[model samples]
Target chain A: MSAVVILTPAIVAGWPTIVAAVAGAASALGLVVKQSVKQDIDIAQQTQATEQTVEVELAKSEVVAQNLAKEKEIVVTKGDIELSVSRDERGRCKVCAKGKGKTKAELKQIAEQFAQKMAQCFVYNRVATELKNKGFQTVNEEVMEDQSIRINVRRWVD
Target chain B: MAQHDVEIVISKTGEVKVHIKGVKGKGCLEYAKWLSKIVGSVREQKLTSEYYEPEVKSKIDLHQQLNDE
Candidate 1:
């Protein structure tokens, strides 16, 4: 062993990268990507009459974009519960969960869960891409019972 | 050639634990720096005994033995 390090992930990427991560998180959670446009949510909010709405922000995230209009949001759904992921005005990633029948606490919990899963997916994608670019070959990759992702990679250095 | 290995575990909440193996001297630190930049901020880090070993000594020794034959 040479070293052991613990890191906390921060998401800093463009809209396309964030969308890819959102797709990954949605698939992991069995949620469907209902739409990729923010206007869809605006219309749904007007018609759905949601009883409880909760917003959770990823603590360490920044959506870097050259054009403000390109910062589009994504909507994911699992039954009646809907999650809208977008970059807030402060550049932080935000996840909003709302449903008609669920309580405020329930919505909050779901929002938080989605936020964490999204962050996990984001970090996994980033690390895997970087490892491949750095000429490291993956030896093994697996998901633990607790849903954590483990990746082992090796490289030969002369 | 030296084989450098890394084991990365990304927790459900996106926290990462990285274990670097087979790298000697400051080369291990270079890996650490690259991973830190990719993932995020390093919360904690520890260096193991292998990090103090001479990086190319083993390979050089192998080359010298081959040349003697």
Candidate 2:
């Protein structure tokens, strides 16, 4: 009753954190992690020349390179669609989707969905850690039918 | 002791909506600021009557008692 606020999440975290979020999103979307490049090894080149490719960049995000090599990518797959998540040269989060027999629009939607899910997982993890450190007790938590997460927390202040 | 309650709803698209209850005045703003820092920039904000109310009811009651005396 006191206040209401709407926020757009900005993803700022280390490479490990980003990878964790990517894993979480992949699991939620029923995708399998095909490859995880933790070191500076050369990633495998795209083998599908005729596949439609779409890239979706997350806004207001900064993926810090702490413990990250010059090149790190997480590749996931769902059926024929392949999604690769990585940080661009500018340290921005990007998701690239490629699938044969799919249109550009379809690939774009798949990339965008993966990006959004990754962001949600990142925000949830950050908020949960902070709330616990701040002595807030979680009173209730649930996932809605729309895949949204709802959490209620309380604390006593002197 | 004052109990502060915060409800956070994170949408599938990663957008967040926060509702703070049982907090008044500047205390409410404190929660809002903390949440915004953890989440991201605030797209919109609204303050209700509770936010405009006195922060400490005990202090107001004490002041009224002194005035009556």
Candidate 3:
């Protein structure tokens, strides 16, 4: 490694970019895009009866969480489990998972999975966009060394 | 042309380690900031001396000069 100086990262993006980030995150997290007649996306709010919807928030959120606003929300459901992704009051993106048949632990696990995917998607979208804006073109991007996504970028700069 | 290369390793856990090459001065910070915005919070940052060196000036500068004449 040559003498390359590294500095603090500066984030320059607006709310619309955050929305795109969410869209990209949704795709990375295996969310299926459905056709909607209207502009707003309404989740299939089911469970029919007066069911319990437990909401749990993560306390150990990172400092970078402050870069977000309450822009977009993604609702994911599999079987009885329902998960919602949105940025919390603390600016940290959160995922709420609830279900009728699952125990509290099961719900927690699902929520945790959603949280992980959100984090991964957040990181992926952030990096790719930044590299592009700085004039770096992607050479190769892939998951490696235990499911990690590695991206190689090259650019001509002065 | 001078080539600036970046290698980003984002772990499955959402942690990232970035390696920047062929970029000098404050220009590289642009890439860093752009990335941190996407990836969430930064845990740690390690800056190499190349960051302190003069910006990477491509050989194309000479070609541009010759073309002007």
Candidate 4:
């Protein structure tokens, strides 16, 4: 090996790119996307009834695309849990999780987990695409027991 | 040409670990920089013994010549 590097991903992208990553994350976590209108109505009606709501900001992330319209968000559902992912006023990526019978800690954990999954999906897509553009062919790709993704690629360079 | 291999591991939390192989000298640094741009900030990095080896240009030329023969 010539070198080894450890990097922490910073997700900064436009709305479309963010949505792509969100879709990847949702699919990986077995979450279903809820219709926007129905999600809004449900959220409005359930806000008062749900005692636990937690919001988690993704670390080192910025949604650089400006002027995003209000209520433009991705809503996903898994069982009784609802997650809303959006870019806040300060351009930070935020994940809000709410469940009817869950505690604040439980909601917080769910939000944090979702945020991690989203970041992972974003990084994986970006790196794999870039490597392909650089003329590297993937030799092996697998998910480890601990859920980490490992990709090996090779290229003949002069 | 020299075959350059890169092994990338993206952790569950989105942290990336990259191991660049078959690239000697400063050439490996170029790959590291390019990957870092695509991924994010480098939390830590280490250069191995291969990084101190001679450049791969001579090896590439030798292989080309052998193929031509």
Best by TM-score: 1
Summarize candidate 1's per-residue lDDT along A1-158 as a digit string, tens digits: 89999999989999888889999999999999999877777777888774688899999999897366244889999998889889888888899998888999999999898888999999999999999999999999999999999999999999
Colliding pairs, model 4: none
Error of 1 at A156 (Å): 0.5
Give the 10-residue window scoring lowest on summed lDDT in candidate 2 chain A: A38-47
Model 2 has a DockQ score of 0.79
Q: Give me the runs in candidate 4 sitting further than 4 Å from their true place.
A: A36-48, A69-71, B56-69
Tens-digit lDDT string for candidate 2 (A33-84): 8887734223334345667889999998888863463478888999999898
> After superposing candidate 1, which stretches have Cα over 4 Å from the reference?
A69-71, B58-69
Report fnat for all candidates as fractions from 0 to 1: 0.98, 0.94, 0.47, 0.97
Compare the candidates by DockQ and give the number of the best one: 1
DockQ of each: 0.81, 0.79, 0.27, 0.78
Candidate 1 chain B: worst 10 consecutive residues by lDDT? B58-67
* Candidate 1 RMSD to the correct structure: 3.9
Better of 2 and 3 by TM-score: 2
- Interface RMSD per candidate: 0.5, 0.6, 4.0, 0.5
* Model 3 lDDT tens row, A67-147: 444445556555666666555666554566667877778778767765555555556776676677768799999888586
The candidate maximizing lDDT is 1
